[model samples]
Target chain A: MNEKMSSRTLRTLPREKAFYFFTSIGNYTGESATSLKEFTDKISEVNVKSLEFHLYRGDFEKWTAETLEDQKLAREIENLRNQNYSGTALKEQLYNILSKYYEKIISKF
Target chain B: MKFKDNTVALDATDLRILNALQENARQTYTAIGKSLGIAHSTVYDRIKRMERHGIIKEYTAVIDAQKAGAKNIIAIMTIFTDPKESDKVAEKLCEAPQILEVYTSLSEELLIIAKVVAENQESLHEFIASSVAPLPGVLRIRTSMITKKFKETRFSIANNPKQLAFIKEKSNK
Candidate 1:
């Protein structure tokens, strides 16, 4: 994947496809991020445990790639996961990547 | 960066930043920078990197349980599980939202100590009788309802040995 996503890929996704946060299996954190910016923002302040759980389970990359049709971000998250990042460390890296994509999304409108 | 050991390449500045955040997490990055005589952006970057390294966990409000009305009734429950099913039982306990914290300690048998909360005595009893008691491999459960609390302490993130280890070894190969 290149550094930038296509215009269509930057658009907001449907509400039902929003990424939900969970602390553990069957434990919801009462937060869902519907767009790139929202994902970036929630990823920063959401429970670290929730972030770690989803990351290890490959939820983030799958949601981004399949629902959002963002192969670029999906691969980025996959790279981070393969690197063995966990907990808050993974959150920080994921936040940085999402922030960059968020800037691209807002600048188009 | 890490050296020969897996230890982080943290410096005095990193230590000072941690001290500032540990003292007061709500303080702004600029405030921390001013106190440390460094640029606020540097402080921001350092903190972000440390978080990526899993050195800093999260900022949370430490509330008085009884006063907050959030988790008023706290109980300490101990479960003795069959040695073979220790991890499985502990993982099952963790799946429940009521269990706040879980720790394992060595005793005559494998002991799982869990801190849980409920709204009232009836709910607490139901949670135990229905949710806890039915778990497979659980030998017995001992629960103690706290009448009062004397002292409590914050859960420091520094003690977490689960910090993200660098994949340097894998990368080298």
Candidate 2:
């Protein structure tokens, strides 16, 4: 329950004050992202903000299922899709979920 | 009839021709004429008129800089110069081969966007320090490196619907 709320919070938070998270992602990562899979893979190396932005824009379900090949993560991401959240709010929600996922993966080692 | 800016008015047929040429400059007048349902001679005459009016500049090829081994670091520099010496500073900046575009902004700062090709970052730093930093009236220089380019386009006639309609209406008459 707490994890769900935190994921929602990650989706909503803004990354930087200089520009919108989407614009910042393009500037930093290069705008060669033609597909959701490419966008997700490229941004994984840079800041998580870009990934958060894509997730907020409702790309996570496809990216997780197709690119990441994580059906569990896809199902988790699907719950947050189309909830009428603003761009910043959606990013914050995504950030929370991604952070937890990383922590869980790291703890196993 | 004259355009709003008092420029030579282009009719609908002229606009259609311009739009087609913009898409592919190498396209033949016969092809353009066929597409627009106009005579080839009419297409040729309209293009000539547009050229005379300075509406159509030189047709150019867009090259991929990365593939050509001309990939370089691009920087947008806002140069603060003495208010009276702004013009002189801009002139000097334009003379530098590394500088691509120069413009004077509404403010006192002189904006210079340049590309520098070098073996490494150190050489680029040295080039800027020796060539750009020492210019007269160069009070301050702030540069932001362009990491990525999303879209760069030449003249886009297709995007201007209002102008297209105005030109089309004139052609109808």
Candidate 3:
């Protein structure tokens, strides 16, 4: 057991290349390990156990920069960008955004 | 992001509580109330209801496995056994002290992810070779040690438009 524990200690956390590739800002064309280190440092203060970077669900094709740049939507996105935006903020922002989309549908009815 | 059918419904206040607790589980009710701008009594009541309904499962600190100095060996052990042998194998695996979490995957593979914090690697390896493999129905064990924790949390991004869109765009080939 002692021998095994020591060996395990030498090992570090595994990096899922695919996971980082998708979540990275802009087109991240660089060494994965290095890029990951940089990304990790940027959000190092944020304490989260395991971040499930959703690699699927809301497609960007649904809305363009112009749509997001609308005064209301822009403020919403800015609020979301706050460094202190935690899980609660994220959810609220999402609810508000979805509600706006819903409003667009309701008005057509 | 759309949740599954059984998604739990939570009001704004409830979500705020969950968010606070997720960041710091040991936070007191009074502290949580102060942060969320709710009364202490309400916080207490909501927590009680959440626990009863199974939303707040348990409070635990996120310990650094490396700092814990244990044999953190995460492995997917495939246990091939008949119906009669299933119970026997599962029983044995569960009994292992080093095994932290275990789950049976849909692929019929017994995914035994373990975080063994031992004094040294030799002891960990010995335990795996001598103790883990000898068990009945244990066919193969593939081990992978976590090299670096880029991001880890029990929280979910079921909502977050930016993150949701980010994921959606990536997945679409």
Instruction: Rank candidates by lDDT, best first.
Output: 1, 2, 3
Q: What are the lDDT scores of the predictions, listed in order?
A: 0.75, 0.60, 0.47
Model 3 score (lDDT):
0.47
The C-alpha stretches of model 3 lying farther than 4 A from their native spots are A1-109, B1-9, B65-84, B108-115, B155-173
Candidate 1: which pairs clash? Answer: A89-B52
Q: State the DockQ of every prediction.
A: 0.01, 0.01, 0.01
Query: Could you give candidate 2's per-residue lDDT for residues A37-103 as a string of tens digits?
Result: 3333344443555555555655557645654455666777777665644455655665566666655
Question: Candidate 3 chain B, which ten residues in sequence have the lowest lDDT sum?
Answer: B73-82
Tell me the tens digit of each residue's lDDT in model 1 across A1-109: 3334565566677655667665653334446767777788999988889888888878889888987888877898899889887777888888888888767665665
lDDT of the structure predicted as candidate 1: 0.75
Which is better, 1 or 2, measured by lDDT?
1
Q: Provide the DockQ value for model 3.
A: 0.01
Tens digits of lDDT, candidate 3, A35-96: 22233342332222111121121212112122222234334444444434445444454445
